[model samples]
Every structure is written in C-alpha cells, then in structure tokens.
Target chain A: MLVLELMVVIFLASIVAGVIGSLVGLGGGVVVIPILTIGLGVDIHYAIGASIVSVIATSSGAAATYVKDKMTNLRVGMFLELATTTGAIIGALIAAYVSSIALELVFGVILLLSLIPLVRKIGEDIPVTPELVGLSKKLELTGSYVETDGSTVNYNATRPAQGLAGMLVAGLISGLLGIGSGTFKVLSMDLAMKLPMKVSTTTSNFMIGVTAAASAGIYFVRGDVDPIIVAPVALGILFGASLGAKALPRAKNPTVRKIFAIVLAIAGAEMVLRALGI
Target chain B: MSLGNPDSMNNVISKVLRYGVLLSAAVIVLGAALLAARDAFSPSASLLHYDPNQIPHGPFPVTFSSLTAGLATGSPDAIIELGVLLLLATPVSRVLFSVFLFAAEHNRAYVYITATVLTLLLFSMLVTPYIPVFGG
Candidate 1:
C-alpha cells in the first residue's frame, strides 16, 4: 500500500516537474528528486540514481525530435558538453570522499540560493553583440523558433561572457551536484547570450545526457548506484515526465511557476532540516 | 530575426526539437518503468540478491570500498552523489538561475533557489544505512 502511494507521488512529482521544466526550459529530474526525498521518503543515493536514469530517458526522448527538427545546435551542445562533462567527473570524484551530511547541507543551500532568478523576467528583447555579430552569421547559431504567437523568431547568441558564466555555474554544479543546470544554461543563452529561449533549451537538453553520462560512469564504477533504489524512481519519473510533457500545452505559465516556487521552497526547507538531522 | 520572430528558420528548428525531445522523453520513461517494474517484482528475487561479499567480490572492490569510505567520511566524498542528485534538482535551480539572468537584464530580486529536494534525498540515503529491506 505504501509502495503504491509512493508510485502516485512519483507520478505527481513528474507531472509537476514537466510543467515547470517546460516553461523554464530545464528538465524535471532535479525537482523530482527533492520531492521524492522530502515528500515520499526516498533516499538521496537512490533518488540520484533514479533521477540520473530519468535524465537519460527524458533527454533521449526529447533529443530525437529536437535533432530531427534541427532546433538543437549540435555544434554548440558539443562545445559546451566538454565543460559540463569535465565538471561532472570532477564532481563525482569529490562526492566519493565527501560526507553525505555535508553534501546535503551544501545541496540544500545551493537549491535555496538558485531560485533568485526564476521570479523575475529578464531581457525579453533580442540581443546584439559585437562578438556575436559574426557568430550567428558564421555558425548558424542564428536561427528561428515558432512561438505560441504563430510567429517565427530569428535569434542569435549574444554576450559570450555572460553565457560562459552561466556555463561555468552549470559546470560547477554538474561537478558538485550532478545536474544539467540547463535552466541556467538556457536562461544564459536567452537573456545574456541573447539567443532564443527555445533554441537554448533544446540545445541544453541535448547536452545534459552527455554531461550526466560522465558522472554516472563514475558512480557506476564506485558502486554508489544501487539498482534497487534507482529502478523505481527512474521508471516512475520517466512515465510522469512524458505525461507532463504532453500536458505542457494545457498548463498555464504563472500557475506552473507558482507551483514550482512553492514546491522548491518547501523542499529547500526540508533539505535544511534533513541536513540538520531534524 | 529575433527569438520571437514569427518566420525565422530557428523558430521551426525550435519547434521540431521541442516536439522531438518530448517524444523521446515519453519512450525512455515508459521503457525504463517496465524494466524497473520487472526488476522490482521478479519472482526470482533471490537472484537479485546483494551481499557484503558482493561489494568486495566485484572486479574493482577497492573502488567500492573507497566510495563507502568516502561516504562514511564527511567533507569531500559527498561530491560523488552531487551529480545524480543535480538531475533531480534541475527544475528548482532553473528558477533561481532564471532570476539571476533576468536580474542583470532589467534588475530584480534574484532568488538563487535549489536544495529542498537534495536535502530530502540525502536524508533518505542516510536512513538507508539504518534500514533493512532485502533481508539485511
């Protein structure tokens, strides 16, 4: 009976994850883990494994279409992947020696601090940069994406420094926490780099799997990945993410963001509590 | 063309990529679920047995033991679990990072959100060490 309830929780978490992830252009795996730990009483070790597996699943699922449509900048993804993959391996190596308690404390703090940007809307305009002037023209990074407005947006990458800073954050977190940090990645491209959000997100999605695989390999070799814990969460999340992805069009923006905010706030508090052993 | 441009080639590319990713996420989720269920409910449960010996018997027992030692220790070892957990925390961090970017664009609150979920995961894992499931 408890198992069944847990399954339901996982499903709900996935739906929530998908809705929020789609709007923000980050995948739902991060949201799902915290929910499972705080709400459903899942272990972080298992939770991480499950979440990583789901990352592969969801990325693969999404990448197929993104690649087919050519919205994903394979070149850009590949370029950035170098940073993320390196960071992930470094993170994995560090995790193996760190105390789980400290890990939780740090992770919770990062999560709490990471939310500052989501509440505000940054530059919604197209950006133009001298560095990017020849960039979009040369690499085909300049492209269009369809919007709900029924308009096509031709966008370019702007503010290479800003975008790189976001990537640096992603790399650190990937190494430190093992996430794609795609939200930051996409946000950087959209706001700082002045690329289309759609393009940024799609490309970020394409890159997450490679980033994760790097660290996951370390976990696999280290025996941190327990199949028992990984299987259910992974499978449950995948199911929910797909359903949520489908529900994306049907969901509202503010409503979803509010839900995302509230959930994270609670989860953030929970992380602090757990780390304190409360 | 801008990101919001109506007829740019990037617009079409974005839509294709979005849809394509959605489809792939679905299949990966469903297939993994089936496999997980099978593993969870298999009649030959004993075959899925785990023992202390299993840890040391592997091709690289030293690596496994070191992981356990790292986890048992307290400062740096915590990093290994960070990557997988990040995937789980990706959604929440998205908002925080978004706030950051937008703040610089027009200037705003900047929340820097993430953690609630990771705390929970760590809490759960810590407890895993105390509990017995498969007849430990």
Candidate 2:
C-alpha cells in the first residue's frame, strides 16, 4: 500500500477505536492495538507504541471535559497516581526485556481478565455507606459531583492502601500492554476506595494520561515510537474521543458495555492465537 | 488567588488540557501534511513505508537539542515528535498544576502526595535513561 493509503487506513481505524473507547469509558488503546496488530498486520511493538500515543491523546481530550464538569476527583486521582506512575515505569522497563510473543500473550490474558468487570457489571452507582479509613481521612480524599439530573452526589474514599495496590497493578498492565487499564483503575476506586461511580470513572480517566505519559517516554527512548505512524493515530483518536465525549451523556451504558465486552473478547482470542503463532 | 479556589483551579487546568490537546493535534496534522506533500513531490524518496517487520526502529534519539534542531530545519518528523512530546507533557503539567493547587489550598497532605507523583513521573522520564538495567 502507498504511504498515504496506509495513513488514511490507520487514521480511520483509530477514529472508530476512539469513539467506541470513549463511549465505553475504556479509552482507545484496547481497540487500537488489536486493530493495528491483527487487522493491519503491524508489529506488536509498533502497534503498542501507536496505541500508547492514542491513549494519551484520548485521555487528554476527554479529561478536559471531565475536569471541567467536576466529575474528576483530583485529590484521589493524584494520590493514586503515585502507585500508577511507579508501576508504569517498572512495567515499561520489564517490557523492554520481554520478547514480543510473551508480551502478546500477556496482553491477551489481561484483555480476557478485563472482561470480568464487564460481566459482573461492577462499578455501578449504588448508595453505600462510606467507610473512611485513616489514610483517606488524612489525605481528605473525598468529593461530590453533580449528576446529569443536577443532583449532587457526595462520597468519601476508603482503604487507601488497597486502592494504591490495585492502581499499581493497573499501571503495570497499562504500560505492559500500552492500554489505559481503565477497568482496573475504576475497580480500585469504586470497590476499594469507595468513591462514587462518576468520580471513579472520571478520575480514572484523568489519571490514565499521566500513567501513559510515564511509559511513553521509555517507549520513545527505546525507538519503538514511529512519528509517521503515530501522527494519524493520535489525531484520529483525539478527534473521535472529543466526539464520543459529547455523545457519552446520551449513550446507554448497558448497550455500550455489551458491545465493548464482545469486542474485547474477540480481540483477546485473536491476540492469544497470534501469540501461539497462529 | 485562582489556585486557592478549587473551581477556578479546575477551570484553569481544564483550559490548559483542552488547549494543549488542540495545539498538539494541529501541529501533528501540519507535520503529517508536510510529509504527504514531500512524498507526493518525490515519489522515489518516500518518507514513510508500511512494513511491520522492517519499520524504522530506535535510531532517532529524542532529546531537547535534536528536537530543536529538527524543528529549526522544518523537519516533518521532528515536528510530529514535538507534537507527541507536547501531548505527553500535558499530563505532567497537570500533575504539577495540582501540586500548586494543593499547596495554595493549604492541603499539606495532598501537596505531598501530588509532589510525590510528579517526582515519580520525572524520575521515570529522565532518570530511567541512566539506569543500565532498564535499557533506557
């Protein structure tokens, strides 16, 4: 294929990934990586590099809207980021030494694991008594956000250490797979930290950019990043994510979750097959 | 004063993030256009080719000096790199901004937490290169 054709194809695919990702609150990397590697026949390393860039793009684009809406809990996000960033650095370094096939297998397994949350429909908004732990209280990691119906839902975080540990694992997967690991982050916040669903999702989105950025530099330094490939993917995801963010409020969560789960399952199976040299 | 107010602080950070994304995307589009134009004019001298196995790998070192030099010479690749750099920098800046915001609010615990996050981020970005085991 000609250079122009290739760019156009990647750009369009990235747009779809970004749109689906934003609507589902998963970010673009999951769709972007599978499409690039399985559909386009791109190398896993290069695909990961491009996916990471798209992750940053989508996160930054959507985060702007989330922050402004006050849906993001900055205090909670910032506190958890310490673990994520550190885990990202470690994961990226480990990735450098790991073989491509091994990385592909790991990615597939994580993709499959990500399905658990979707199946269980965890992280939904249910009124629960806030369990304020010592660390959460000390850090004052509590927040409230106005819902779509204009009702303010206030909440407090608990089990700070558990959330931090979960974030570390989430960050590790994100760096290793070049995806946002949004499911894991949300799980940590919603389950462990006891944050409201809105705050957990938005704050997780807010932290993803920083987590990806930490690992991206390492990827760039290792020469995995290609400017030519990244240009279209980044631009496409950014544009698509912005549109998806606009559409998110009106989109039905159950429908989006089902679609996202199906996509992830197929992508995971394909990745495993590829890893097994199929 | 703005930093002391959570609402204003969030507004400022949001604007920064939005503008940062827009600026980076615009720069990347410009660079992509330049690349396409260059290829169109000289078909034999293609700047991009899609070979998954033989794609360009790890030759270009990204540093401030090289980026500046490439931009000065109007190198399309460098321009694209700059755009990526700006995208990565946006999140880092947000963390930094949070540090100041927390400090202004006299939230000492959060100020410490944010600062720690920022420090870890910088360590990964800058200090990791010197560590031989990480192969940075």
lDDT scores in order = 0.48, 0.78
Query: Worst ten-residue run, lDDT, model 2 chain B?
Result: B52-61
Task: Compose the digit string of candidate 1's lDDT tens values, residues A1-278.
Answer: 23334455565566556545544445566676767566556666556655655565455445544544555665455445445544554454455466656765775676566567645643233334334455444443455545455555565665555565666666556545655556556655655665544566667766665555444543454354543344344444445444544543333434445544555555556557777988
Instruction: Summarize candidate 2's per-residue lDDT along B2-49 as a digit string, tens digits.
Output: 678879778978888998999899899999998788777865633445
Cα displacement (Å) at residue B91, model 2: 0.4
Segments in model 1 whose C-alpha atoms lie over 4 Å from true places? A1-12, A69-71, A96-131, A134-140, A223-229, A243-278, B1-136
DockQ comparisons of all candidates to the true complex:
0.06, 0.65
Q: Model 1, A277: alpha-carbon shift in Å?
A: 4.8
Instruction: Identify the leading candidate in terms of lDDT.
Output: 2
Q: What's the residue-level lDDT of A115 in candidate 2?
A: 80
